[model samples]
Target chain A: MSCEKQSPPELPGCQEANGPLDFQLRILSDPRLLAVVRCTVAEFAAVSGFKEDQCRSITLAVDEALSNIIRHAYNNRRDQEIEMRLHADIGCLEFTFVDRGEPLDRSKYCAQPLDAVALGGRGTHLIRQIMDEVVYERVSEGNRLRLKKYLPPARLTP
Target chain B: MTHLLDDKRDATPMKISTRELNGTTIVDVTGEIDMSTSPGFRTALLESLKKTPRLAVNLTNVRYVDSSGIASLVEVLKAARISDKRLVLFGLNEPVQEVLQLTRLTKIFEIRKTEKEALEV
Candidate 1:
């Protein structure tokens, strides 16, 4: 796990003026690293004022995102690279994942119904349900997925 | 009546062991279950299912579970239904219970609070 502190990206409503906490993480696309990522992100969220249950939910969302990248984007290649950026502002927390693998088909990215009993395909649903915003962009180099969750007023600190 | 298998890998953060109690196969799992460990979990589950008509999983020591773990449980449950075998899960910590509720899978599986209840069910 390699991580560095960096300036937050310039996205709408997320500005430097908000004093956002920014972090970038780079890791090999190994399934074994999923637990490490979950612990890191969950602790980060907790320090940002999220409750225990909310932290767990956020951790699960991030875990699912990384899992999808390992399975679909990198095609189960453990040696590939995957980068994640976490930006936590006063109002929201955002995660950006970048990977140079098979781009996800936007037209085919719908959450499977929870009523169906399936072996797989629940990762996407869990992410969408847990996060406030889910966006996928096919970049020139690879694919980028951004997930966001708004913080409640009580949880937001000065 | 006997301990069937005990599987633990030095490279993985999961351990699985199984024993028989009153004709029911009790699978005790310890540690986190994620993409790296779910395959072994699935195999252990399926193998236990093959040995008896009733299988009870003890998840009291499991602290975390990812989507892959849930998928493994679903697959084993499907197989149990097909073979007329029983699959019961007990001692789920809060995180594992919430994951099942979030996926709306609590409606499908038989969940108990204790090993005694799991065996009775």
Candidate 2:
């Protein structure tokens, strides 16, 4: 099993205390699945104590991640298995995407400049903006992409 | 190991409702616009372009949009500019606004806070 873990601050509902509040999803590499997964991510963020706007940003970030995986990693090969794991705690929310497809070239990753009028390549840029930490690793038969978003301190205040 | 939602893939079809006001075509879209749905959006937008030179895309009801959706809008915007037409977008929720901001596209498009202002632009 491929796993990419986020280093979370000691907070309530962490894995050691509340098992990290996780859900595993296995969906075919299909664009039709993006909406459902986005909805699920929104719910996850909302329940994880994120504000409404934050929840929307988080959902878009994860959706872009999955879209990149389907388009780049799997090369748009439908029906291929893609595994996703969502973990949340009081401190942060993390998403891990595992795919048994092509390894991404790290050197060529660049988000287009904002002033430039273009499209179809803004995923990485959006992900970096929405998430606090992003890590990618190549495994034996697949690749792992991990995204983490730290909860706002104001939201955590009781 | 476990699937959360049921297999309801074919449930919601993206709907684009268009109307004419003040010689501008207003396109109100609702539903997710990712790879599966951008084609329809592109077709609708292209058809709408044939009708009027000024277009306003109302995304107030749209909950989600991926890069492909953005690509469709960009294509239409380029076409509109080449033909000396005007395109305006308004009522962008936080998520939609964030996506545009992150991609540095906020400056490239004419964005308004409400339909009234979008029409005025």
DockQ of each: 0.38, 0.46
For model 1, residues A64-138, the per-residue Cα lDDT tens digits are 999999999998999999999998877788999999999996655654686579888888889988999999999
Residue-level lDDT tens digits of model 1 in B4-121: 0122325548899999998899999988899889999999999999989999999987878888999999999999999999999999988899899888899899999999999995
Each model's backbone clash number: 0, 1
RMSD of 2: 6.2
Whole-model Cα lDDT per candidate? 0.84, 0.80
Model 2 chain B lDDT-worst window of ten: B1-10
Off by over 4 Å in 2: A1-19, B1-10
Chain B TM-score of candidate number 2:
0.89
Q: Largest TM-score belongs to which candidate?
A: 1
Task: Residues A1-158, candidate 2: write the lDDT tens digits.
Answer: 10111222356755464346899999999988887787788777766777667777888889889888888898999889899999987678999999998999676575456456675677787788889999999988699999999987876663
Chain A TM-scores for all candidates read 0.84, 0.84
Docking class of 1: acceptable
